[model samples]
Target: MHLRQFNKAGVEAFRRFLEACRENPKEPVPVDLLESHEHTVLTSKQIVVEPREFSSRRQAADYFQDLLSPIPPDAVRKDAGIWTWLSLFYFDQICPTGNGNRKVRNDYTYIYMPDESRYFYRHLLFIAWQVKQVAPECNRLFLDSSLVTLDKLTTEVFKRLYLTRIPCLFELLDRLYWDCSNNRPAKGIVSPHKISAGDLVHRFPTRIRQLEKTYDLQSLDADQLLEILGDEFRQRAATSQSQMELSMQ
Candidate 1:
């Protein structure tokens, strides 16, 4: 179907629908509300969006990036209506019905809150799309999980403004966490105590902050950053690389 954006009335209607869904999670989404032309207008840049299941957030991001390429970046970013509409379009994936119920979270998780900077990053689709646009290289580390999961690693990395903007930081994260053989993040990286003393969840960002104070991190690439990291990270990187080599043999 052609891409569309909700009008102000449409957004309000969507909000009301969400409230109802929260009250009765088993209630099916109204097809009429989703398809009503009066509630939504065609997008300025016409693009077809078919109903499809995405294996991972990475795939979904890539799909959206390609589909929305015709529209200006700023236009896409600022348009809350379009994103909210997309959320409704893929409601089943985001809030799957299982065992006669759907576990819907806070409204912000599905609806794009453009005016509220604090909640802006909470929208699942918007955040996935934004992260892919900003840090394409870290997709394996960040977006490899199923569309519904908002993993700790992704939350930790993206919440930090400095981390998101730096190309070197993305490279460092990829080297440290991404499992090349499996094409997924290294196991236990996200758990605070699961990996080791200094895990990605608890220590990586703090360590980077400390390093930033003492060094011009922007000037350093991933290799240099690796050398500067504590033994915990270096050892893990070494172990991962060794395993990768062994797997290839």
Candidate 2:
């Protein structure tokens, strides 16, 4: 009866309402919907999504430029600029933006410098979730300075809790890099090649290459994470629809 989001069940419920409107034509709106002002909440909140866009590597290099702000972009150091850049974009893309009907996706793109051969599409859900929790105000601060309003102090306190509990998951990323580097074994004894740890590129693939799909892999790759999320959303929608149909019957 909540009908919070418009899945198949919510749709069916809406159809029933419309049918009632046709059949009775004079009855007051359903209490479950008219009980509050939340009926149109989604419409007011939905951000319009634009067409997806791609970008070149040189452009990516500029956006990922090292931040000179109070917090360093490369928190783990060793100049993981690409990883840092990807994390932000990736977090923003992990889910469809809207809660109902066509959750808008972010239009984002980036590329590697010089080579420009590989283009990476990123979705940084964990990072976004962390920021949403720890420093949400900071997350939306946007460096404008003028936008820092004190209206969200309570939310900010929770944001602080989020970061403390998660630590932004940097250590976990470090271990992932270590694993990716060791997996190849450097084609046997990679020393004497003047390769530093910084030279190693940590490549997470588009799928769950080896690990089983579980909470254990909260930060493996964007695509797999999105897949898990998509499945969950689908299952929840199906359940809701089933419940709504059951109730009407």
Candidate 3:
């Protein structure tokens, strides 16, 4: 969708609905009714990049953060035909924006940064999970599970698995069936490998205080890191915005 004018209106309408939903969780959400009237706020991805004389790359990244905060959902709804509008590779980190706003006809969301792995936004992955719970009929689901056991995987891995059938996030999860070995090295096919050449498909909770000695990731807080990164991003956006103004002048 060209960020159609109607979509911009729709985005505002969705934001209003989000606010209302938070205010009244018990209220009946007439999704069909609200969506019918909502116009898409953005008409398209023709959003001009108004860059400023950014003193540093950090300033440029900050601008993107500011730009992302105001997007409408129609640009990213399952029904609408939009994808992340701009590149995520602005600086050291992969600052996320339209990562969540892009829409696919099937309602399955795929966000991969072909440039770098750090630019991958996990929250967009989370959104698909959330939509599954709230609107399973609206979308089918898949996820790439390769990240479950690795400290790091390259951007190629994220891309290779993103559109493949085996990439569905839940495809590989299974119960441990112990059998056939007296003293085992955890032998036998624990599970069939996901992510075959055929197809590409593919959270943690907050608040669980996992034991410090636990081998798996128990708990973590990315607040400080997020804040510091957020600050850098703001500067970037400001610079970009300034540059846009200057060009216009």
Candidate 4:
């Protein structure tokens, strides 16, 4: 998905979007054209182009701050509504903002170009995951509808499963579904089923590293991969429990 420039026209459009949302909170936004950006943009530009050009860092920061200021107070009222709006309308606007601040280059960059993938801005996906905590039902709906949009915008592993031919991937989605249903904590080391989909996606690379020398996943079949993932999940659960126990000592 293309990053929305926090330019004059984009900012005004967002304001109107928020007004529309406040007026009809439950009614879904007309997102068909907006949502279709996934296939179109990813295919056209396989890289995150630097969308905003600033003459100086100060100008960019001021522009970003403008975008941040108009966040509707009522947007946060429905929990996931605000974040959904953010993900949909504003996430890309300030993605390349400075130091997580509006400034240009601070010591850190909040958003950057996608390296090997066609997506960028991972923190937004984490925010999407956070939506599950306060608004599970809302989060579910949002995830169901917007996951493709998110996948189009970021290099997310969960998105990879959407196109995966592996049968175990469906099992993984099933486990995540049940985890959300059960209201398990999304943070910390835990069973794969109990972890948030976004958290699991974030941690999977590391977990894969933990198993790299132990299993040649590339050589395994779908069922074998499923078993291996289960083994690792249980090991992580046990490790989490041990750490929790030690913390009490």
Highest lDDT: give the candidate number: 1
State the lDDT at 115 in candidate 3.
34
**Candidate 4 on 89-125: residue-level lDDT in tens?**
4433433333333322211122222232332234343
For each candidate, what TM-score against the reference? 0.89, 0.18, 0.22, 0.28
lDDT tens digits by residue: candidate 3, 1-249: 222222444444444543553455443333342224354233336544442433322343345334433454432333221222221111112221243332111111222222343443232322332233322231212222221111112122233332122222222111111111222111222123443221112111111112223322212222321222233333433443455456566
Better of 2 and 4 by lDDT: 4
Worst 10 residues of 3 by lDDT: 200-209
Against the unseen true structure, what C-alpha lDDT does each candidate score? Answer: 0.81, 0.29, 0.28, 0.37
What TM-score would candidate 2 get against the native? 0.18
Model 1: residue 165 alpha-carbon error in angstroms: 1.1
Q: Could you tell me the TM-score of candidate 1?
A: 0.89
Between candidates 1 and 3, the one scoring higher on lDDT is 1
Q: Which runs of model 2 end up more than 4 angstroms from their true locations? A: 1-5, 8-41, 53-165, 175-249
Ranking by lDDT: 1, 4, 2, 3
- Candidate 1 whole-model C-alpha lDDT, 0 to 1: 0.81
Q: Which stretches of candidate 3 lie over 4 Å from their true place?
A: 1-6, 33-249
Task: Write down the RMSD of all candidates, one decimal each.
Answer: 2.3, 23.4, 21.1, 16.4
lDDT of 4: 0.37
